[model samples]
Target: MTSSSKTLGEFFDSFECEAFRLETLDDYSKSGNVDAYHAFLAGQPQPSDYNAGWVEELRSHTRAGKRVHRVHILSRPLTDYLSFELGWGYRKNSTGGEEFFILDITDKPNPLAGVPDFWCFDSASVVVMNYDETGKYVGSALLEPERVVEFTGYRDTALAEAEPFVEWWAKYGT
Candidate 1:
């Protein structure tokens, strides 16, 4: 199928084996849950319903034996947005069976430097997510078939070098 023929949401709903994401940004505060971000910044406790829908969506996939996970590429001295995302968002999401990892490049060089944020579904299809400088949601593109080979390679490298989120969080989480 052509790039214009598929949407990321379609991929999310259909992937069978695994859905892997590589997050290359330190901040996505302006992208989704603006109100929750604001509340997090204001020092309010996370609402009970925070990310409930997405968590349910994740549970639906993981309970059926598929995998959903991501590796976030970041460095030392976490940004406020990163603090909110990791401390609140990731921890909350993981409860629903989504796995996470942290690939901190504070000391070592990032092996996948400059790679855009992408989601690889079943290691077969890739959808590149776009964001503006301020981290506002822009759009996404379903990459052509040939590009999945390179993205799948990137995915493997990320998983190989990254540490599980629980372990990383025990050491570095805010």
Candidate 2:
């Protein structure tokens, strides 16, 4: 395997036991309009019921001094997803001290130019290709104007290269 791939594999191996909560727009609908769906879910009788278990588990981890890492894969932009999930999780787990690490890969340039990348959301250590329209990726920062971090690459690579960022989050994210 390539060195980058190996590093990622090792990282995963170390955190294999870490529980991850995966929620996708597709889980609710194939139409892929997560914003609208989010609104719909909000109007539900128990809006926080869908991922209540996950929220509680995350809170538990936080209470025990474990940081909660969240990777959101989107077919559009990170801003909307982050806002929705973070807002919901925050509302549900108000007392929990949890840090969310989000890796949004919506409009990443292909490692090789001229080859069109697929437009879909997938996740492993981080969420990748969360938002792609016409096979073009856009970063979460672009989607959410408030987020200052720029999109560099896929989540896995970004994490591997961004040690300072990781460290900062680890140290102060909570």
Candidate 3:
């Protein structure tokens, strides 16, 4: 299918080699996995099935030698939502061979300031993820082919400024 006709979900299936996600928001509690987020806040142990479906999907791609990874731009003194996402979501997702990174801008200046969240598929297609003020996922916009270069640059910059999640978590994870 042409990239224009494919939804953001379809890009997940259609990407041949790699997928890269950039997460700028500090809280996405309202976007998904609300129950789990609530349980986390209650100090309850994470459920065994937490993020099971997404983990499996990551495995499917990774086992096939496809790569899926993301860099989250964040700072020290992480928000509650970030604590759950990184401590639970990211840690679990790693088991499926999905990679994670942290662009800790706590002390350093944000190089890609004002850049929105987006995904680049195989470095060919770009989809910008939109979220409301409260971190509710509003929608996504699939950019034209000409914009691929720009998004890829953003991805590269994030990766360049970020450190591996494992290492970052060890030092600063709550």
Candidate 4:
């Protein structure tokens, strides 16, 4: 696409084949679900409609033979927000055919150290996620085409050291 017309929304709408995300934060409580996170902290049950929009979007993509998956690099003793994200968000998002994996670096060095979180679409385009220290979503930067090789390497290395979320959660879920 031309620089004049490039947009994240357009990228999401146009990408084919697959979408991969890397999440390395312990808490994204301030991103989009402020109320839901508070409810989780306050002992409220997860609302049925939580994340309905994203779920439907995933369904639309997967239903069309596209893949949406993520690898979350996290450790044991998960934070409360991580708990909500895994037990509720991941679990619910799976219903729409999104895949989750966990790269537990609790006992070892991070192989993908210093790599910022990003989403690589169809192995071609990459949009790097930008966040504040408090885990707030600031914005995303679309990298130049020449840098896809670097991001693809990160994705491959992450997947190599990760396990499916269902299996890992079963063995170590809080």
Query: Which whole-number lDDT from 0 to 100 does residue 127 have in model 4?
Result: 89
Write model 1 residue lDDT over 98-137, tens digit each, in one string. 9999999999999998899999999888889999999887
Q: In candidate 2, where is summed lDDT lowest over 10 consecutive residues?
A: 115-124
Score candidate 2 by lDDT.
0.37
**Model 4 — which ten-residue stretch has the worst lDDT?**
1-10
Q: What local lDDT does model 3 show for residue 154?
A: 95
- Report model 4's TM-score to 2 decimal places: 0.95
Residue pairs clashing, model 3:
none
Candidate 3 lDDT at 44 equals 98
After superposing candidate 1, which stretches have Cα over 4 Å from the reference? none
**lDDT over C-alpha atoms for residue 3 of model 1:** 55
Which candidate, 2 or 3, would have the higher lDDT against the true structure? 3
What's model 4's overall lDDT? 0.91
Per-residue lDDT tens digits for candidate 3, residues 53-165, read 99999999999999999999998899999999999999999989999999999998999899999989999988899898888998888888888898899999999999999
Q: TM-scores of the models, in the given order?
A: 0.97, 0.34, 0.97, 0.95
lDDT of every model, 2 decimals: 0.92, 0.37, 0.92, 0.91
Ranking by lDDT: 1, 3, 4, 2
Q: Which RMSD values do the candidates have, in order?
A: 1.3, 12.1, 1.9, 1.8
> Which residue pairs of candidate 2 clash?
74-130, 74-131, 75-130, 75-131, 76-130, 76-131, 106-137, 107-137, 107-138
Query: What lDDT, from 0 to 1, does candidate 3 have?
Result: 0.92
Model 3, 134: alpha-carbon shift in Å? Answer: 1.5
The stretch of ten residues in a row with the least summed lDDT in candidate 1 is 1-10
Tell me how many residue pairs clash in candidate 3. Answer: 0
